[model samples]
Each structure stands twice: as C-alpha cells, then as structure tokens.
Target: MRQRNLSIPRTSVTALVAAMAAVLYLCLAALPVHAAEGFDFYTDSPGIHVTAGDALSFNLHLAGSNAAGSDVALSVASMPEGFTGFFKSGSYEVTKVHASGDGADTIATFQTTVPSDVADGVYEIVLHAASEGGFEDDLILTLTVSGLESGESNFHVEYPDQEGVSGTAFSYSTTIANNTLNTQNYNFSSNAPAGWTVAFSSESTQVSSLEVESGSSKSVTITVTPPEKVEAGDYTVECAATSAKEQLSTALNVKILGTYGLDLSTTDGRLSFDAFANKESSVTLKLTNSGNIALENISLTSSAPAGWEVSFDSSVIDALEPGASKEVVAHVVPGKDSLTGDYVTIMSASCDNQSAQASFRITVKTQTGWGIFALVIIIAVAAGLYGVMKKYGRR
Candidate 1:
C-alpha cells in the first residue's frame, strides 16, 4: 500500500465545480434588505418563509401613537430574488411581475414580486418613512419560501478525479435531469471555482433546460477552465432546473483526480544545493500519482532567472498506474560569470492542460579579483615581519 499522491486533475475537476456554482445561485434565494427606518418596526410573526417561485401577500401594520394620518413617505429599499418593490392602495402585496396593483391608500405603499424558480428560505424587505412631526420609522419584514414545486428536476456534479491533477484547466460536465411528466424548459447554471471559467458547447455558455418527455432525460455538458495557479481541494455547489411551470434543484460535489504535479528531491520534499559558480548539480524527482485514475503522457518543463540554466533528462512518462509512483531528475547550473546570493527557477510537469510546478534554488560563490588581492596583502605583511625577525637573529 504505497502512499498515493493526492493531487486533483485540473481540467475535468474545474469544469465540474463551475457547473455546480451556476446551479447554486438559482436554488438559494437571495434575501431582500431587511433593515428599515420607521416607528420601531418589528414583525409580529418573526419572519415569513416561502419556496422558490411562489407568491404571497402579507399585511404588516404600522402601530404608533400620534403617528397615524401623518403623511408617511413609504419606500422599499431592497427585496429578495424574483421580487419587485412597488405599492398598491395601502396593503403590501407580493406578486409576480406584470401583476396589477390595487390602489387603496393615500400614503405610499410597497409591493413586490416573487420569482418562480427561487429557493426556500427567509428573505427581507426594508421599509422606510418620515413624517412632518420629526418622527421617522423603519421595519424588517421576513419572507420565507420552503420546499420545491414540480419536484422532478435534480442536478449532480462530477469532478475529473480526486487524487490529483497537474494542469491549470479542468473539464467538467453537468447533467441536468428532468424526472417529471410534462415537457419543461430549464436554464442551466453554475458558479465555477476561483480563477476558472464555465463554458458550455460554445465556450462555457449558458443554456436553457431541455424539454424532457415523460420517462425521458436530458443533460448538458459544461467545460471549466481554472486559473493556472489553483491547487487541489474539495468543492461543492448547487444547480437548478428552471422552467415556466416550476423549478427544481440539486447539489453537486466534485473531486479532481491526480497527484499535484510537482516532484521532490528528498523524502521530506526539499530541494538541495551548495554555492558554486560555473557548476551543475543533480536533483532527483519522486513523482506520485495522487489521482484515482491512471495518468498518461506526463512531461516536465522549466523556467529560470537570468544567468541560470535548467534541464531535465526525462521530459515525458507513458503511464502512471493509479496510486503508483516513479522518479525523474533535473539539472541546475549557473553561467561562468553568474552573480552570487540565491538564484531561483520553476519546473512544471504537464499532461495536456493539467500541470504543476516545483521551485528550484541555486547559490553561487567566486574567489577571484578582489578576493585574491586581499589574500596577497595579508601574506606580504606576514612575510615582512618574518624577515625583520630573521635579521635581528643574525645580528
């Protein structure tokens, strides 16, 4: 049972994570602004909860002594997803977009619309008003939607492999499945991992949900391009299926497969060298396959600073059995007139777009010119004192 490298595959894993994020935005409902300035505004019911794509009207009363009938300018500052702020006559009504308002109150009223594909949770709507008598008011109204309607759509995320990946870009595929009877139109969405892009068939594009027939299914493929600097890790995201009839949602979990691409000189994974100008040193690389799946066509590449050079004996490997291990070597050298102190370079191993890098350091030392002059001055002084002592002995 050799220790397997725990690097994730870059391209495949990234794509999957991006898809999950897109779906998450649609399932989790954004809460409306819940802070307001009014007569010590408080909700008698604590909060109102609702599901994605559902609509409701709530009656909130403004109770204050000597504050009634004073022209209060009611304004809604914020609202949750799929909701708009407006006013009817006096009562607060939450409806879909394009729904009519009932004009009833002399003072301004606030209304909103609830989107059909939002998630279940509590949302906030902030209300504010001011009076001529120097009285001001604010309120935090709670809106909660629970559970899913149509309940037939689900989303699942898949990463490339969990062990490790070498490249910067990962490819992910998302399957948006419709489990209900009626044909549904859906919007495919995701939030990609940091430094990554989500592309569908047309380069990480957005897509509408497929119209699935009863007992049938459809899926969309999304490609994720992660930044070249991302490391391996576990990431989760939410995905949703949206249509005019109703919305459905599911969670996606992804694991990029492969070992982190860098290799090591010592078992503790440290690079080693001594100060030497115009000399080269040898370092060993112990490559590990951290991914669940085997890797193929592995190769090494390098980058160095001025006056420093690097090369590798083995640039490519054929196959890495899952959980297997192998080794390679890298050479570092400084030019004849290279400066001293510390010189650094980076070596990357890439398979397709997946890659990883190892940092290299070199030290230089020179014992010429000024160094030789100092040594000669010290020797001459010592010789002169020896000559004077010899003259005294002869006398």
Candidate 2:
C-alpha cells in the first residue's frame, strides 16, 4: 500500500474517482423520490342556504405546496337529485383547472342550481379535485332550501282581471304552490271595498285557512261580490296568502259594466184602467232606464184579452239615458163581443236582454145602443099584450 501511495499513477486516481461516482449514483438511484404536495381545493364558505329557484355559488381557493401547475380535474362526487353543480373560471364554465401551485389562477367558482319545483330540504354535495400526481381533495358542500323560496311569491292566477256586473260574483282562479319541505297552514285575507265581500274556496268549499302539503299545489276560487249599488267602473281587490313562513299578495281587477234594466209603466203608475167594449182608449206609457247604463232599441209589446188590439206610438225607443224616462202613446181596443167584466193586460218593455212587464186591468161597459134597443122591445111587447086582451073582451 505504501508503494502504491508513493507511486500511484494519474490514470489509477482517475479510475478510482470514476468508480466512486458510479457507487454514489447507484445508491441515489436505489432510494425512492417523494412527490411534492401538488395542490389543495378549499372554499371559504363550505355551507350555504338558498330558496328554491335560486342559485348558490362558492368562492374556491386552490392552495398548494411545490405544485407543478398541473391540470386539476374537477368533478362532483356526490349530489342530491334537486341540485346541479358546476365549476366556473370568470365567465367561462370549466371542469379542469390549471393550478400553478404558486397561487396564480388558483381561484375558482363553484355554483349549484336548484329547480323551482323542488321540495325544500338540506342537501350535500362533494366536489373532487384531482391532479396527475395522484393528488386529490374532496370538498363537502351543504345547502338548505326553504319552501316556495324566500321573498318570492308562491301564488299564481290564471286570470287576475275579471269582468262582471254589480250584485254578481267575480271569480279568480288561483293556484298556490307549496314548494317546501314541510306542511303549511295558509291563511287568506282580502282588502275589498266597503260593502264588498271576498272569499276563498277550494273545490266549492269556502275556506279561510287551508293545509297544504309539501311540493304540492292547490287551486282556489276567489269570489268577489260587489255591493248592491256599486258604480260602474274598475275596482281592485287586494288579497294575500299567508303561511307560517311565507306571505304573498296580489291585486285583482274587477270591471263593472253596469246592469241592464227596463221599467215599463204608466206615468201615474196606475196598473188598472176602465174601458168600454168596442171602444178605443189611448193611455200614456212611460219607459224608464233603471240601470246605470244606457238602454237602446227598446221594443214594446202587450198581452191582452182575446180579440183585443193594442198599438204603441213608438214601438221601439232609439236610446234612453241612465235614470231617464221616455213617454209613448198606447191605444187599446176591446173586442166588440166582450162582456161587461174585468180584463187583464200585460205590457212589456225589452232592451239589451233586459225585460220589464207591467199588468193593467180593463173594465168593459155595455154600449148605450144595446140598452136603448132592449127598452124599445119591452115597450112593444107590453102594447101588443094589451091589444090582444081588449080584442078578446069584445069578442
């Protein structure tokens, strides 16, 4: 060994150095190399709550330690039936996120959507983020849904506006949707005008409050009755549907077009009249518009004793204003053979599907000519009888 140290050649030293380098390389190669912790997915708010028909979003942060900016694939590992989850980067929706592991482009948006018709309840979703280096993370998200959605109306009307006349019912078909996880007792109320009545009914049964099941809908009939003398115009009925957790209000329109009416009578309002047989008598008839709307094309007709004739000077009135009247001349003639007795006559006025009838009585009197003839016959009979008696005595 002393001789080798003293006389060691440069080539030998070089060979030794090369051998050591090889051994070191072998040792290093035999040892396993650990992979770096690529990236991590997390959200500041892992739990949230929203009503049905609303969307929920979470701001995600991708933290890493010595990450290689690998493409992290995002997926929802678990979700409920009523929810849909997705990832977004800015305005573009994406499923793969490129994480530099250096905190650049590490923010993402996770959004979940719920259907409007879904029932209310709590839901859980698991978001999975995976990378090429077998690095992965599962984030749990929680969601709570209230029924019918908060601050949103749960009532729908097939027809919010209705048209009718006074003293009639105006109906509105309404549908109430209980998109909740629990049953509810809904109370109804209305702010109608004075002397007006508002009622809510289901299946023809009136109800002030009703119990509704979850995820179910109920149809109700809203009946609004105007006052007796309600003016013709547009009226509003404010109604509300209130539950334990929700309240919805709506305004309904009711159009009043007035009513159709006709009044037929004498100016003095006398229902009876006396008339002689085979004589024509003229009477003044008055036609009044008893409704708030105008009346037009009013036709006059009469029903009287058999063989009697009746005529109107103005058979049809062109138009009559509300609360106004028009006078017409009606000539009535009795049958020649009619006896001295009481008779009935019906006068009718009709316009615009409205009709009014008035009844009158007539008394027929015997003609003077008939009475005079009867007296003359009696006198002739007496004179003949007396002449017969005198002739018999002389014989």
**Winning model by TM-score:** 2
Instruction: Give a tens-digit lDDT track for model 1, residues 1-395.
Output: 99988877899799999999978876564532322232433334546555555444444444454345555445676676567666555344432112111212123334456676666667888765555555556666777666644555665445534223434344456565655444556765666656656554422445544565544665556555544445556655455666665566555444544344333334458764665666787677777765555668988777877676778788888887666777777777777787777777777777763456777666667746778899999999999999999989787
Kindly give the stretch of ten consecutive residues in candidate 2 with the minimal lDDT sum: 31-40
Each candidate's lDDT (Cα)? 0.58, 0.83
TM-score of 1: 0.39
List of clashing residue pairs for candidate 2: none
| Model 1 misplaced stretches (Cα beyond 4 Å) | 1-268, 367-388
Q: Which whole-number lDDT from 0 to 100 does residue 71 have in model 2?
A: 76
